[model samples]
Target: MRTRLMEAGLHDGATWRISPTPFLLTSADLSAIQSLGQHLLRFTHALNRLYYESVRGAQPTWVADYLDQGKPPDLIAYARMNRFRTALPGVIRPDLILTEDGFMISELDSVPGGIGLTGCMGQAYTDLGWPIIGGRDGMVAGFARMIRSLHESREGAHSPVASAEQRVPAPLPNPPQPSAARLAIVVSEESKDYRSEMLWLAARLREAGLPAQTVSPDDVIFTEEALFLAGSTPLTALYRFFELFDLKNIPKSELIMYAVKKGHLALTPPMKPWLEEKMAFALVHHPALEPFWTHELGADTFELLHRLMPKTWILDPRPVPPHAVIPGLTVDGHSVSDWKVLASLGQKGRRFVIKPSGFSELAWGSRGVSVGHDLPQTEWAAALEAALASFHQVPRILQEFRKGRHVAVSYHDPVTDEIVPMPGRVRLSPYYFIAGEVGTEGASAGPPSAKSVELAGILATVCPLDKKLIHGMTEAVMAPCTLA
Candidate 1:
């Protein structure tokens, strides 16, 4: 490796001078990751179905309203369109904290970061002849496959729905691929953290003779014929590199979705905000909805998910009856009637995490999280009060905190130019890439179609165990994971 390249490290824009060598996972670890992908794929399908069913009075009215709140009406309706009824995000990355027992998935992201970072690092390491997990081509191929599949799904023939009320997929004719359709990744200003990595990814794809590049939403120009970047490049498929919450800030962002709705463009993470929330995990643990989840996703899948997901409860600040207690929570050694009482929990009782529901800037990164045990009593109380206060607008959830076990890994010490050993907590974010036909034959089955969700790549962030919040290149060692 060149000295300049080593000095630059993984920075396209964000600088990460971590090890050039990747972290190695055990084969058993790999198997567990693959199993997680299969289960989550089925879980998301069932969750989506459950959401719509709840909207139709099969469940509760608050379900749909909670997910749809603060979303643009047109986009909500567009998301619910029969054309997108079966649509799932092609890329799924879950934040898995490695505890002594195993892994506890803390968060799931549809529009996740680390894709381009994972791609660039994996490709670089693969070029060095190392056996990287998910292979060197995993991220790139996964993304390209997603684009291609989304393009085909949108262009294919549609089956007429029995009624507007019924949201079943109506498959239409399969449109042939365009001879010269182009691909570009459009990033919004809010997601500049990964812009450079995406550009590097595009350059890599271009070297392999693919039409790929990264463009900002501001650079996109729409015409009666198609949506073009810089007025000359017609985009057949677009991978949205921005979050749904910040789309309004992008110049002419509305036009891109308009283009998608009019058949001039194909976009994904598919303008679906519901899938982007962290609160979906809490819904999976809802006892009242367990039957619906089991019916939509078979009992075995539900059981797996139940065991996988930690105990979580959506925090609603509505006052409880004097005789009633909040499920799974207590204060002062008794059932509590008020939400404010949660703020006074002592250090021993603060073994939980407070997270936002989503649709806000706070939803991304570590900004929206409050690690109870890590904070002082006053600070913890204050954070809990703030979260409770935001119940109506920005909902929050409390999840049982799972402590990550310390693991030893070596990192590149740029100062000494040496590889040194360090013990840190691991956050395993495995990128499960969905390809081929994503339409699951039976979401209620035990596992999803294994071929649909493939193990694209794994990103391991090993941060100092002392650090409560893990993210970015700060003191953390970021690397592509391998089962070598």
Candidate 2:
């Protein structure tokens, strides 16, 4: 089978390279894999519910999208297979396929490319001196484990419907390892922090016993000879064009995936337009300048979710105002006047929290103004002007105030959906002003809560445009072009 795939140009050195290890499995691996598959299914289901909630007003007609489409039978079969207490008799093939709607279990070979993380997992396991598993096989096992952990954790508890079971076979034998090959790591001088992170990941890969090298992006001059030797054009060549603009610090790598700062130079005018064409990349953090990047986070996450999921949804920030700004309310059959906006706040008698629309951190002296206390009439008017000015700088939203303790939930795929909650923190001073309180301690504690993650997951499933916008934003940031 592997030989046939190679002859068909499906293996490495042909067109799309198939990893050497295919379906490495043991009887013990089945339970873990099943659990992960189940979790992914549940998460997808939950996301679908959230999506429905998000687009209810905008596209009320498409409300029954999930139920109307119906579940793919392959997914049903795979779901059943996950619940089998004992290893099934037949050769179990876990074919989890991700689609726009959700994941369906398809033929094993039908999965898409860019799943190198599975190989990384295998390498990690091997480096740990565990029994060597084939790369492809390790991916299958690892994916199974990830799904199982996610399922058991119930992170998708918000899902409206429970996941149904399907029968799947037990693990097969270990496949052969592929011949050793040199993988390149592209780096640029400009992004030292990113370059350093890549180098660190490479070192970690090396510790996992994989041979890896870090090379400067500019240094990787692409020529016909080099391309011929590698049996193809080096992907790193794409980034070299940016050097014309003295963007020498940009890093490029065929083997290492790039991570760009969300709203920084990576997505500046010169680079964004060019990078959008390529689908080989994935973005890490959502870009600040482009709020839509958050939608694309689901693409990778959906790959993790689609084993047994019916659908998924994501939130659209457009309709909902930011939590900072207070929504205007109707009073006595008429809308409140602007003059009364602060007057209304004064009457509340509590500290009023002001936030710029879509912006998180409160501007200095603009954090929380205690009505009638910290804000006297003179000061209140001035602060109100400042808040309104800053709000107008972009889009602004306001929230009355959240005096409750802040906590965050982190979603982890551990063959169960694990939601870990931690305390949230706010910085009282800037790092330069108070290093300990503002810099390190504050930064670590500002992540969103578990409820936020759940909310985000739901929103992603509902809004299709959100996903497209996010992908566009991510590509723009990660694959910025250099000026000629």
Which candidate gets the maximum TM-score versus the true structure? 1
For model 2, the superposed segments whose C-alpha errors exceed 4 Å read 1-198, 209-340, 343-393, 399-484
lDDT of 1 by residue, 314-415 (tens): 777777887776665655568656767767778988888898878889987888899999999999888888987887778888888888888878777766
Q: Write the residue-wise lDDT of candidate 2 on 193-232 in tens digits.
A: 2344344434443444333444566454444323211343
lDDT of 2: 0.26
Worst 10 residues of 1 by lDDT: 438-447
Q: Name the TM-score of candidate 2.
A: 0.27
Pairs that collide in candidate 1 are: 157-171, 157-172, 157-173, 158-171, 158-172, 159-170, 159-171, 298-444
Candidate 1 wrongly placed segments (more than 4 Å): 1-9, 12-14, 158-181, 231-233, 330-337, 438-451
